[model samples]
Target: MVERGEPVRLCLHIGMPKTGTSLIQSVLQGLRPQLAHEGVWLPPNNLAAHRIAVEAFAADSRLSTRADVEAIREAITFEEAVAHSRPTSEEFTKVILSSEYFQQCSVPLLLPLLEKMGFSSEATSVVAALRRQDRILVSGFNQDVKAMHRSTPLIWDPDDAHQLDWYALLTPWAETFGKDAIKVQVFDREVAKKESLTCLFLEACDVSYDEASVTSLEVSRRDQENASLPADLLAFKFVANGVTRPGEVDWLIDEAQARGVGGGVYGLAEETVQAILEHYRMSNRQVALEYLGEDGDLFDDVVTAPTHTDLTVDPVILSSLLAICVAAQPRAEGARNHHLR
Candidate 1:
């Protein structure tokens, strides 16, 4: 929120995916009404995260034409009175636009689009949360398998290793919006739980609020945003993906999330883990020095590479999981739930 006679602040929480994005989006989305009362607004893209903004921007970023910009506008702006409401420039002291894919906005389209949306560059800042590469990769792969509607088993591709390069990831944002405009937070699950991610996000944005109340605010995670399946269930779902319709498979995905059956997305040997980490070590270090003002490693948690070679679930867990799948309600083909939105 802005002070009297000061510019209204705009905070764009672009994501480096899988770094508690769901939880962050969930918390902010849950707090939208409360935040609105305080003169800080998070606009809705179909009632939750504004992921379409980045997709729209990326579309224009590709073609670099005036028509592409209009296409971007057409993609994100809803003229229907019954659709999502946006605050007028005078309505709010501060505004937050968020989407995990926003980190990918490199071209000039984003800033000009925001200008059209009534946010000036001087009042805008970019906020991001970065996860350790190895963990995010595994989690990202699990998500791709679960929701990407993979016709074949989704395997983590080596090509995606470039995604682990934090330096490369953030550089475009810095170039597009000056380095000083970027605010970075290193993702720590333990710390986030201890001090709610919502509060952490507010702290990052310099938004004022009652921390206790903000932390206490609760929302249902029924859509199971970014929930991962345990290796066994993941394997079951992966196999089923080969044979079943995407909708038919949703029942197991939903059930697995509800029961909290989650584990390592992939069993990695120590050598493999070390290889992945070592590959991106420098990129992360650059980010630490350039953005976080820290020295050495960007992440400090102890790395535990799963040592088990067997992918099979214990018989009992497998049986229970299968039974739940059998008894679970099937969604109509092509149906998807967006309870959080």
Candidate 2:
């Protein structure tokens, strides 16, 4: 438990995406003021502050520019200002920073940046939520289609050493922060049945979700929080991406959603799913034993392999494709009209 007068503890929620990360961020951002009152600080200036901080430290040439530096500096200044404004009786006990992109950052680069932000390595804890590999891959593929607007699936090499290897992903942080400092929670049905992802996360951060916090969250709750594209919509988007200009994808997504054309799940054959899982089986065991302190399977349930063939288009998905084609016509006509004029 965090003591009120202790030096601020920084909690970094680095994500392995498709693990309810966006919802967690949305809830925290929405309840920032109430959380601050409770002495937990989720910086308001840039929700992606940690992402930018990681990029800036990794020296991504694009983010290393003066503008990026100033942006991070501004965020730091804002956090400090917020810290100072708290009532004299309470000092911030924890600072929560989240970013899914931090999963890509190396610990060597990430640690120095956290130190610069007033976090001591000893006082910081890294929290991550992980999903089964098969589910993660399918969800990642869907995210690429929806968020990245990719016409084709992202490159997948079954033999690739790093992709989807839970152990590899967690090892660096465990090595640096010590295995005890790293907390891993399985994102599965059993956990979901007991508590929400938001609540699970708050617990990990040592933040209390008292009656007031629950009421505030309920009041501001969105009907859809980081909802995924329905499989049919996802399939339609996949096909549309092949022909549409990159800049036009967002418009296409918005138009499709407006028409109420959605529903479909990306799937893999049982053999394929099992094979992929086997590839990471050993690493997952290590992670479970070493970091999670679990002797059994890392995930609570085995992924239910799909009976149907992968990426099979059924009647419903076909209908969604038709809707997308019809939706694109108006945009195409408008573009032609502008050209003629």
Candidate 3:
């Protein structure tokens, strides 16, 4: 399938999260100048492509009968804004959307949309990175607690046990599109680090790797403070619409240091992480064997995650987060007009 504005070449970079997706995206952003020099347009629309893909997947009854299209549509609205802001230029001809969450959608749903949009399997390249299950969950939970979100209940199991079944999310890509077209890399947070991963990913996206180093600038606006909820709070939030005052939640979250609660409190048990990993690994192992055989070991290898001390938060992340929050909230027409003035 082909898209009107999309160049003949398209790359869909899906992911196994915490695999330096943010860092990769930032680096990709820097390459926009160089990419434009090469006639490539990394449309801002893909900034939230995963959310759109997921929403689309859920909304299509053929893919997910219980799916909520409105939720997904709302998520894609941010990407739409980015698309709207793009300037018409001859330098950009191709477009790419990068996100890990896109992995959540079912292939059946994605294929039809792409076909309908004129993007065929032949014209698309899929990219994703994998990390050790053990460490991925640890960092993911830490992110959740920092944002005052809910953590998983399973926290004491083995490493590689507490995650969404990886195979369930990834295997389909290899199945739908030949494994050769699906670029899967095991992310070793230590060896390549963030910048290195960006370099590797850019190479996959058909972009230049020599242009610049990864920026500390955070561009995504998604909130990460999801820790697991206490039963009552969960019930209230999910059931009662959990109406939270804007900015109030952030202030309450800032008090974490005084409370002496470290972010680890939100992590799932080690066993749970391991279980989740093994559950998916079981299915993924089959795909690996089918695709790689003896060479499958290369794909199954683990990438060591970096230590907390090494990960730094860029202040820019705050601005981007605020932008997303404001976008999600309802604004009065007069207020929007006043701001514009």
Candidate 4:
């Protein structure tokens, strides 16, 4: 239990997505009751409050249209009400909030929401798991391809500049919360040897673990919360996204999953991967030296060449995706006809 006079600590895990965030969130959510018993409070009302908070902040921007602002304001009001109603029990020593969207948020945008949520800058400890740039780009691209509203083709041109700039992303948080208040962990397999991402996150939250605790927190091997699609399936989905409605595309993805279409992670060209790594090399090194106090490279290994298999869509998978598009044609035609009328 928290001492009567001390302020509550907030463990804010702002994710750099594709760094096993979903897995961590799922495990934390599952272990909420246990955590509460141990004086760690996970928000009961909103399991994913940070995501909604970030979205609201984005929509509330002046650059957004009035309708968007109003809608987001309504959402913010609802979330604020929920947060206020939550128990302010003194038994709780810490609060845990995790969301990948928070990584995209600026200090001005994020700080206000944290204040509203009853977390002070002085008491909050921000944690971010950083992945290597080349790998992150591929994962981020796959995510975009899988998204409903994303329509642009994925490109790796030097001019296009990927947003996996760790230095820029971390600076605001570090400056606001103090360098020591922000903990940076490398999201690599070798780094997390013996312990899983779930375990590493729980450790960061100051949660103790025994054999029984480990057993209780372990997610099943079969469960894939936000697993990336195979190269072939990803390619098919990328092309199919252009023609099909979001709903149809979702069904197609489910069907592909049902058919066991996954092989391994999608790969980018070697030259493209090298170019991206070189782009962020200095920034990554700076982050490591300043935040982590490591003189060596931030990444466990450099991307000298492409690591995964080529992005070749299997013939059978391509045919299946084409069929999905064909099936959606009637609905598309009906919508077009209605618009004409």
Best by lDDT: 4
TM of each candidate vs. truth: 0.78, 0.78, 0.60, 0.80
Which candidate comes out best when scored by TM-score?
Answer: 4
Q: List the global CA lDDT of all models.
A: 0.65, 0.69, 0.52, 0.70
Q: Write down the worst ten-residue block by lDDT for model 1.
A: 77-86
Better of 1 and 2 by lDDT: 2
Residue-wise C-alpha lDDT for candidate 3, range 1-341, written one tens digit per residue: 22245445668888666776765665566566766677666655443565547644555445344234345555557446334323346445455777665766777777776655445677778887766565565656454433334323325444444235455565677677767777766675334444466667767777654543333322231223233433222222222222453334543234333343233122344445545555556555654565435333323433333222212233443344355446545654668888999
| Per-residue lDDT of model 4, residues 1-341, tens digit only | 22357767888888777887776777776777888888787765333455444444565455345443344545556456445424468888888777765665567776776666666799888888998877877777777677543557567766656467888888888888899888888887534474577777777777764446544555453164566677677777776677877655677787678767555566777777677778888899999999989997888655544334454567877777677668778998999999999
Residue 178's lDDT in candidate 1: 83
C-alpha RMSD by candidate, in order: 6.5, 5.2, 9.7, 5.4
Per-residue lDDT of model 1, residues 36-140, tens digit only: 878886766432234335434454355334443344546554333112434554667887767664655544666675655556787778888888776776677
Model 2 backbone overlap count: 3
The lowest-lDDT stretch of 10 consecutive residues in candidate 3 is 231-240
Kindly report the root-mean-square deviation of model 1 from the true structure over all alpha carbons. Answer: 6.5
Model 3 local distance difference test score: 0.52
What lDDT tens digits, residue by residue, belong to model 2 across residues 1-341?
22354556778788667887776777777778778777787656343455444453465644345453555555555346434323333466777888776786668877775665556788888888888887787778877777666776644477674757888888888888888889888887534575567777888888887656654574467433555676666766677778886556677567667777655456776677777778777788887898867787776446564433344445775666567878679988999999999
A best-first ranking of the candidates according to their lDDT comes to 4, 2, 1, 3
